[model samples]
Target: MKLLEPPVSDYSTVFWDATREERLLLPYSGDRPFWYPRAVAPAHLDGDGEVDWRPAAGTGEVYAVTVVHRPGPGRAAEDGPYAVALVELAEGVRMLTNVVGCPPEDVVVGMPVRVCWHELSDGRKLPMFTPA
Candidate 1:
């Protein structure tokens, strides 16, 4: 089954473009990295929040995980038992992504993973994770 396309806005356009090339980019302010691409970094709210788009190492460890028994909207029931994980990237940012290439039961906290891509119907690539 096809997954829903992620919303791409002007602020996140660079991120989406990097994903298309099989690379991961994160928004940064100074040395701190953040997710959910925005014009301003969460830490530099007071001063001028200059966002820098930078490449990520694309390696991370699973911080949390869950097995989905029931598929949500736009998902197929036959694809049940998928592993959804919160991965803490090497840059110290956590992103919600699917953990594939292995059984859901095998996904556990602190498990190492690497970036992978899932192509959407609209030609956009969605980043996912698999065992590193």
Candidate 2:
């Protein structure tokens, strides 16, 4: 799939940059995880909306999954059948990414997974999930 990066001008740049290094970075503030990689603090969005990038454990469970038998674009189209999943990270946040390194039929909800990377055409590494 295409690895889309937020522009440096965007607040989510930290998330994209970290992934480029093969790391999973999450937006966190206070003591909880502010998921979906938004640059917002857990509480007090108006005041201390400032966020910090923290490393995620990279271990998670598949919350949901869908196998694409035919993709219209991106590597999924070239590669054919692949699994897209919502992975619930150990940090208590869920991210939508692809599940690789196995046949798509093998992906299941509640399946254990770990972080992996797929180098995109743009030379950026995209985080993917795989059997742990």
Candidate 3:
């Protein structure tokens, strides 16, 4: 999914673009990989600018979650009380996102999930998770 507040760095721009294409990018440090955008490679990696943008499998297991009983400002009322989860992707990168397509009670730790994108009115897509 696309971020509501788009990142302002060149490296992150690649990430936003990939999300628009319905893909996820995982940052790699040689054979070890991670997520979230960073300017430098991991301390153990030996090369400069060695990080490559690779497509993620977009599948994960729910590591944690919470149900938002109260709606936040600017949030859609229809989406209130939604379950937001921390998903640990198959690549070992964890991302925080809302989990849709199931009741709040149905969301649980270790549940299998798939990445899904939602397009906002401004034409930006945001990543979300749903039960697999």
Candidate 4:
């Protein structure tokens, strides 16, 4: 399905850029393990946060999940439900994404998954997970 793409910004742009390369970038500096691209962490008291990029193994466990019977804009029109999951990466960060290569009903909490890429028409490769 088509998801809402955010306007380009200095911080988030770097994230989208990395995803295009089939990589996932999460801000990790001083308690910022799982922040989404926008606000990476609590603001540093006296200085900008030391943000750096680390290559994630892209392997994770399913932390939580839901079966989306109702599709949204740009969603694939299929029989019905699809799997959307909150995955906790090996790096100890959690991400919200879909579980593909398997049925939504087959996905279970604590299931293992590996990163996969979905190439968009705009040339962006978004990260999704499939059963490992």
Best by lDDT: 1
lDDT of 4 at 98: 88
C-alpha lDDT (0 to 100) for residue 72 of candidate 1 = 65
lDDT of each: 0.86, 0.77, 0.77, 0.78
Error of 4 at 54 (Å): 1.7
In terms of TM-score, the best-performing candidate is 1
- lDDT-best of 1 and 4: 1
Enumerate clash totals for all models, in the order shown.
Answer: 0, 0, 5, 3
TM-score of each: 0.92, 0.81, 0.80, 0.81
lDDT of 1 at 118: 95
Candidate 2 error regions (>4 Å): 1-9, 42-47, 72-76
The candidates, ranked best first by TM-score, are 1, 4, 2, 3
lDDT of 2: 0.77
Instruction: Report the Cα lDDT for residue 38, model 3.
Output: 79
Off by over 4 Å in 1: 43-47
Any runs in candidate 4 off by more than 4 Å, and if so which? 30-32, 43-48, 73-79
Predicted candidate 3 versus true structure: per-residue lDDT over 12-40, tens digit per residue: 67777777778777788776676665777
Candidate 3 residue spans exceeding 4 A from truth: 1-4, 42-50, 72-78
What is the C-alpha lDDT profile of model 1 across 36-124, one tens digit per residue? Answer: 67877786444358888899999999999999888766778876768889999998989998999999999999999999999877667
